[model samples]
Target: MSTAVGGTTRPCPECGARVPVDERFTVWCAACDWNVDPGERQEHRQKQETEKRRAKRPGQGRLEEARRALARRHGERLHTEMTRDGADLRARRDGASVLAYALALAVHGVTAALLAGGVLCLVWGWGGGLMLLGAVLLVMAVALRPRLSPPLGDGTVLRRADAPELYALVDEVARAVGTRGVDTISVGKEINASVISRGLRGRRALDLGLPLWEVLTPQQRVALLGHELGHYANGDTRHGRVVGSALRSLATWRYYFLPTPRPSLGEMIVNAVYAVPLLLVQGTLSLLDHLTLRATQRAEYLADREAARTASTEAAAGLMDQMLVLDSIDVFLRRESNNAALAGARSARRNAAGAREGGDLWTRLAAHLASVPEHEYERQRRAGARRGHSVDSTHPPTHLRRAFLLTGPPAEPAVVLDEAKQRRIAAELATARAEVARSIVRDGVA
Candidate 1:
């Protein structure tokens, strides 16, 4: 399926339905959607494997199911709470927030304690062992320090001088969402967009992934800005330095203590010594994750609500639809990259060098997405509903987010992007877009 489409058609193996497919892409039946989600079809095999594993370990399957059931109940309750709260996050402060904040402080306290203890061991305690221990603790503390290593680079930054229209659009969206606009805008290679802060002054930057931004309609782009800026308006615990850094520190601690596969005798002894600390760090991280789960989910929901209010509910829903079929879009890119590689390989055999076609990656991407049938999008939605997945693990399930939007009161576009401004924004992104497309063709998707 690496070749370009429009060469042939074939019958679906599942339902004998004629589907328009070439050697170019996933041959799923348009009629019955056979092979649309191969993973769903493996339920029987998964159940059999589960049963076989369960025979060797009593109650394992039931235990896992029970945990899932418990988590599902928690999610339902949180959803109901968010629904009752509506889009108003003003009075949403509760025990969970306080607990999360307190835990974050405690995590930071551990780091401080490490630093303090290290100094004591080095300067006060007079022993070679103590000095060695001090050095180790200092290294660990430094590794766990909370710092904002910039997500944007110098070359990638899109100055307001360059993209006044784009920056103006974002500023307008920020006003609609009840927050100040970001300091800068940057386009990058990721198929996602985010608002990140840098330095002690906390200068905000809106980083847009060219692929994701290109695929979005102008109004949908408004929704994207609305959502990202909404995070700034609605402070997120998980995104905050205290809790966020604590989670990261725990992750670093886990990495340091992780067990290695195929360990030598000395390594085995080391792992045995590290196992308890590893388990403790992992459990701490899990506790932090659980405590902040609903907070993060609520943050995303509020962001979505802001998106709807700013860009209109229809456009917001359209943006959500894009997220639903992100997998298909990604698959299409990989397919395109693979085809380019194959073509280059064949050419190299003849010309003594591989030469990849470039500059049309964005055009090809837009066409591939535009050409996706409505039914395919429907299939993706249904699959998402079944799988209970979201754009990010921290966010609520896509179906739930969709329902939250559709079931709410609709809003007209508060921040509209007229055709003229739209074109100006496109003009601003043109050079960055072309560069991203060429990079994709050259390096390909990871």
Candidate 2:
């Protein structure tokens, strides 16, 4: 449990122990970790009751149990290997990686062949239908080619000139993680943050989810930065255009191949015709996912370590605590945005037509976060553990990542957000925060 560092003392509601609670952060008893993720309620369920929603067949349960056991073993082995070499954070490739790469290359090669064949068909074919088929093939080839990511189109964009202090902080964190800082910062309403390479030039852009940012403390914020910057250092194959786009294209193909709902007689035949191609697409996706998942997970762990190292371990842990309440945050945002109390005030949304500020969504969020009782937080944590949820399917379990942080090497903050810099950064984000708030208030923050 994180002993509160620089915050004022407050009486713990649970044990009445004096505990330090940081402003705008997790308000929990440091002594008891009372409001922190307390797992499993003591209450028991009826012996006869079962969550036994049976699968398609009788033996399915046993098969699933075996699979779960195998997955658990695999996860344990990878965890052990990752922790084995603290200094070496590179995702070690096995035969699977090589096979995945070969498959990706083959996919690209097939696309090239399709384009060439299409051109040849167009040149040689006399029939209009043949020419049309050639044109379709060419289009498919072009569509399936590896491509760069496009602009998010939403969120307020902040450049170096717009937020010098924020950029300076990001640059410092990036330097710590051994990556050139991002060129642009896009702040939005989501409860997540990430760094992505944008455009053909691969300009790194930091996407800061404002709701997530507002709730974290200064050092925790630095840890968040560290985690994102560390992705740049850790080679994530899922982010690579070649493999990434290949996966996307396969998924797209699979979508088109899906059987028509409540199929007519002709549609049934059509579905049967596409069945093989659908299976091929699915199998390829599975192969690529299985190969890249371990490495992606490793990258996430390494990033967590970087977060712990760059910001302090305490802060990193605290950040995890904040993460644990993300569902709560989302619920709170949605509820508050739809509140009858705020309806009239929320009606006047800020837009391009005339910019009007929001109803201080961040402030309400902070208050809601602070107000969440220990019992509720405990319930959420326990539920999360049972769920074994991660940030994504590619990530390790949230509880596991939190445990990893605490067990990892401790470090002093290499990039601290002092109050002065914090205020300046907040000033930089104020307009955007208000914009996001207005959007949420008007649209109910989906």
Candidate 3:
């Protein structure tokens, strides 16, 4: 009897005997006493497992068909509305939702009231116990106030001095989109780009992911820059900062006061006592989040239209398609690379080597993806299609977006880049890519 590996069966190298394949990780040819090393067997099993999981999302074919039909029926009108009036309308409504402020006020006001009541209770016997509880509640509320800004993890700032050519392009896009330029540009180790506010002052910080930049065409680059800058133009970032901060604060408040049950009896009793009031707070915030969800999705569409205006219709649609595919691919590749790197590191440690291989993992992964046959790529894409009408989703579906762009009015004074400038931009991005790759590999090993 011959033991086998999980992957495909092949002839044994030593004796030319057939090797059986099964669920076991290791392959052994009993007739020839042949076997693969443990590391090779482990790697082969992981690749099979990864491929199976990567292509198994519940497909969205029916949902996509419905969206396609809807786009055919009303896409022109929707595109017209989005291009002409959507951004302004959304900004106004978001500004009008000042009632979102109630979430923050309710939390702070109730906490202050509790503290005052506790002080008043001190006038009576047994007030000390009540006062002690109130102080704890007050401290929790104060601690729960959200951080004024999002964390910019491991992102290197791309200053104007660092790349004047890139800044010139960014400034050109900002001007075309009718917005002031970003305060800073940072390159990070992920496949995403966005504009974030730095603090209460609402300083605009633009983030460009190196992985994303490396794969984008020049026109797609312009489209993405316009879309992000459009958020600033239409006040999305400004209003979002306030509403989003409130939501985070409310969530933090709940976590401290209404934690999930623990084994300890004392903590459980405290959680039970605080749960009811925190429930009210969470309910109120949840309602506000629901209302904002629609606005946020609309903002994304409007920004896409803005990108079309600043760049070309083709460029905008290309960028949207890239996003849809890149998001899923990034997740899958990042995980696989991290796992591979970790395995190599462990192997090196056991062998007493100072370092492991698999440097520039992202570049290697990108090359492999680029080399995939068109038919195979399409199959993977269809398998990963997102479900339609994700109510909690922040952006509209990619298919709908592409359809709208196809039907939308054309832009005047189209954005075009000279070949030299395109080459220059790509060179600048190569440096950023190298930096992010090093960061990713270092973090993976650590």
Candidate 4:
């Protein structure tokens, strides 16, 4: 007997895979890739062509052109700086790389001097009351240092035992890159990986994005992890600890120095008078921040170089491309996944199995991502490439990184997990995925 083609009950005639009928009236078996209509293919091609033409219109390239010009200018200076810095590092002087550190020290030193001078004035100045006021101003300057900690993402910490496969990979990368091994690993929903200092001991914590892991090939995953771990080896994350502390301190001091509460006219006068010295400190920090921005960008390139060395350059470039896609859609996908999970939670028991891909959140997300057409992905990739290396941007432009990677000698693939191992690693994270999804929904990622 011949199989029917129009209903969910029937399978595809050629491959016998289930062909679920939908309102679109396009008959096909997605599982076995059979019986796609010619009209549908033609329709898709036409739609893509139309979108492509629209994207290439005259005004479309205007902003990109301007950005590229600016990027070229910044790239020239960056090339010079990185060249010099690289030579210095090769000479074993990276620890003393010129930074805004000196300025940060100066800012703190000035604050202490002001406080000490104010104390002296309070003891012996012309008027005791005026000197007391000066002392208070100086004290406030020192107390209100910028103190924001880096954001610890909303997710669960997975110990080495819990994610041994991942920890093993971390160990391999750490050994290859010659950096301290990660002290802890956390699974989070971010579309990016980050290495953060965990405690007073500065033990490195590695945060991996589960969604990011889902999309990347094993080699690309190595590239991603290697890139983050590379930061430690390259001394970029270390510099971050130094500069970040200073920047945070400046912010804390700025906050205290800035007037708080609703001040009456008389109080406002006093507050404004006190703000004069505080503004100088803020201005000095701002200038230092401006000067050091390029150093941060160069650090990113240096880290990329390390990743390319550890993982193949191709994998590193592929990571940059994938990251562009993630940056574009991560929030949207997270919200959609949350919505799907919430809906599934409210469904009948029978409907639970009916939920897409056996009610797996990651599977549902993969399906949603698969629905984005190739051209849309290309569009975002191109857009990211065009954003150009701005001076203030921490990461260099994706195109620039790709270009730099291509210039280097090709690297052997550093990490490759067999298919079974990849599946095993993913299976180990199944429970964590559920926990993370619940966290996302609980935290209301949307």
| lDDT of every predicted structure (CA atoms) | 0.76, 0.74, 0.63, 0.65
Model 3 per-residue lDDT tens digits across residues 1-446: 44445335667779988866543224546465455333445757865775566567434544544555654434334445655533344444554255555555565565567556655555442545766665665565467655568777567887777777888888899898888777788888667888877797878788887667766678888899998888777756324665667776677766766666554888788777888978877797677765565556566776787788888888888777676556445654556556655555675452222123224555565674454333333332342232344434566667666666666366643567678998887677666766566555545311
Model 2 weakest lDDT span, ten residues long: 42-51
Kindly report which residue stretches of model 1 are placed more than 4 angstroms away from their true locations once superposed. Answer: 1-37, 80-91, 126-129, 150-155, 346-357, 389-392
lDDT of 4 by residue, 1-446 (tens): 23445334457788886656543234555555454433446756865775676587755445545655765687766665554423433212232335466666676565567777777777776475778777775676557533324667776788888988778878888877778778888887776678887544677788787777767778788788888887778766334565666676776667657885799999888788868868876897677776566566667777777777777888888887776566445665556555555666754532442333222656666665555444344544454444445645667777666666666368876666568767777877777777665544444342
Which tens-of-lDDT digit does each residue in 1-446 have in candidate 1?
22235455666777876676634345577677677666776976998899999999999989867766766776666567667744455525567878888987888888899999899889976666799889888987888775544445423678999999998999999999888888988787777889877666777888888778878888898999999998878887766666776777787788889998999999999999999999888888878887887778888888998899999999999899888777766787776666666656664442221123446777777787787766566666666656653322688777677778887578899998999999888888887776666556655653
**Model 1, global lDDT:** 0.76
Mark the regions of model 2 whose C-alpha exceeds 4 Å error after superposition.
1-59, 84-88, 126-129, 150-153, 264-266, 340-342, 345-357, 373-392
Residue 232 displacement (Å), model 3 = 2.1
Estimate TM-scores for all models.
0.85, 0.80, 0.67, 0.67
Candidate 2: C-alpha lDDT: 0.74
Query: Using TM-score as the measure, which candidate wins?
Result: 1
Per-candidate clashes, comma-separated: 0, 0, 0, 9
The 10-residue segment of model 4 with minimum total lDDT is: 88-97
Pairs in clash, predicted candidate 1: none
Off by over 4 Å in 3: 1-91, 94-138, 237-239, 335-386, 412-414, 427-430, 441-446
Model 1 is weakest, by summed lDDT over 10 consecutive residues, at: 347-356
